[model samples]
Structures are given as structure tokens and as C-alpha cells.
Target: MKVILTETIESLGIIGSEVKVADGYARNYLLPQKKAVLASQANRNMLKQEKARFELQIAKEKAFAQEMAARLEGTSCTIAAKVSDETRLYGSVTERDILNALAEKGIEIEKHMLLLSEPIKNTGTYNIPVRVYADVEPEIIVEVVAE
Candidate 1:
């Protein structure tokens, strides 16, 4: 029996895939679990329509990420923190501090997207890479200055 998978099955195929399985397995497992629908002509047509819509939505998201990446290029933010005489920060600068600084400039970013190897501990200029999209990465300079 041929069916359209609603979700990925490791041994079978990915979501929206059409595969042939034993009739008993389809009736007893996939159908009962709502993991697939019979691949009738009508269901295949519906899947085609849904796939078109999903492709369009994915294109839009990729374009938006590209635009954000362009805007983020060469942008820099400054963070001030208390430091000892040796220029070591009293506390390290974190993602939240970077987010807040960017927020002040009207640039909103998620904390998880900021890839920091470690917190900033010294007074210096640092370049931070932000993953704006799976394919897009933009660097922004962060100046850590003493308060």
C-alpha cells in the first residue's frame, strides 16, 4: 500500500514522501497512529499544493535573513564595565550585555544566535560573529571599555 508520510520515519522516508508499505502495517500502525494518509489521487494533489506554499514561505524567510545580514555588516556596539587596575573586567561581558547594547541602537537580536567562545574579560576590541541565518554570518565589532 502506498501512503504519504505526515512525518519522518527513519526506516521509511521523510515527511511528504510517498512510500509503499505492507498493507497490514499501513492499516495497523501508520493509519492508526495518524502518521500517514493513503496516497490517493486527491491526497497527492493536496500535498502538491501544500509543498508549493511551503517553498514560497521558505524563500521569503531566506530573503529576510539576507537583508538582516546586510544591515548587520560592519555594525559595532560598545559595552562599558567596571574593571580592575590591570584592565581585567570585574565580571565578564555576556550575550545579554551585547543584546542590550544592540537594542539601544534599535537592532534586535536573539541571544542564542551570538556565537561567543567565552565571555569578554579584558578591555579591548573584539569582533563577534552572529549567525543571522544558516548560510549568513555577519561580524560586528564590540569595544569593551572601562567604566
Candidate 2:
């Protein structure tokens, strides 16, 4: 069945896109979930008009993401933890710690956006990759110091 997607669906289509789906799936899932509307002439005309606004909104979002990425690139976050005499952290720095540190620096980020291979076990400086946008990945330096 032909439908106009109201929002982006994984493995399907983006917002304001016209797509064809199985009749059963469209009727049972998309329609019931209000994720799409029937691709009638009237609905298609409305979607066409809304497409321009949607494109503009997406562009603005991308611009904001880029700006955030730039700011993050220039920023450094520091975290303090109690460590043993060997300079090894008693407890490693996890995603939550990174998120909290960033928040304290007036930068808000989600846990999933940080690409951390492993927690920090020793004290030093580390560069972490953060995905501020889907395409924009900026590296931020994190300094781990013993308390």
C-alpha cells in the first residue's frame, strides 16, 4: 500500500516521504501507530507543502549539531577520582562519569554518543570521540587526575 510517512522509520523511509509497504503492515502497524497516512491525493498535496518546512527544520538541526561539534572540539573536560599509590583508578571512569563531567562543563551529551572502547584505568589525558551529529564526530580531550 502507498503511504506518506509522518516520521522516519528505521529501514523504511524518512519524514514526508512517500513509500509503499505491504497492505497488512501499513494497515496494522503504520496506520494504527499514526506513523503514516494513506497516500491519497489530498494527503500527498499536504505532504508536498509540508516537505519544504521539514527540510528546513532538518537543515537547522544539522547546523546546530555542527556548531555543537565545533564547540566540543575546543573543549576539555576533567574528572577527578581517588586512585591507588600506583596511580591506577580504584574505579574506572565510565560513560556516566563522562556524561556528568560534560554536564558540569555546561555541555549536555547522551551516553550513547560517546565512543569509549574501555573505561579509564589509569590517570592521564585521553581523547574521546563524540558524535554530536550523525555525520559530525568531534574529539574531546578528557584529563583524569587523582584526587
Model number with the top lDDT? 1
> Mind giving the per-residue lDDT tens digits that candidate 2 earns over 1-147?
999998766457567889999999999999999999999999989987898987886688779989889889957889999999668999999989999998988899888889999999999999999977667899999999999
TM-score each candidate: 0.67, 0.69
lDDT of each: 0.88, 0.87
| TM-score of predicted structure 2 | 0.69
Query: On residues 4-79, what C-alpha lDDT tens digit does candidate 1 reach at each position?
Result: 9876565686567899999999999999999999999999998898886646655776799899999998899999
Number of backbone clashes in candidate 1: 0
User: Candidate 1: where are CA atoms >4 Å away?
Assistant: 1-49
The global Cα lDDT (0 to 1) of model 1 is 0.88
**Candidate 1: pairs in clash:** none
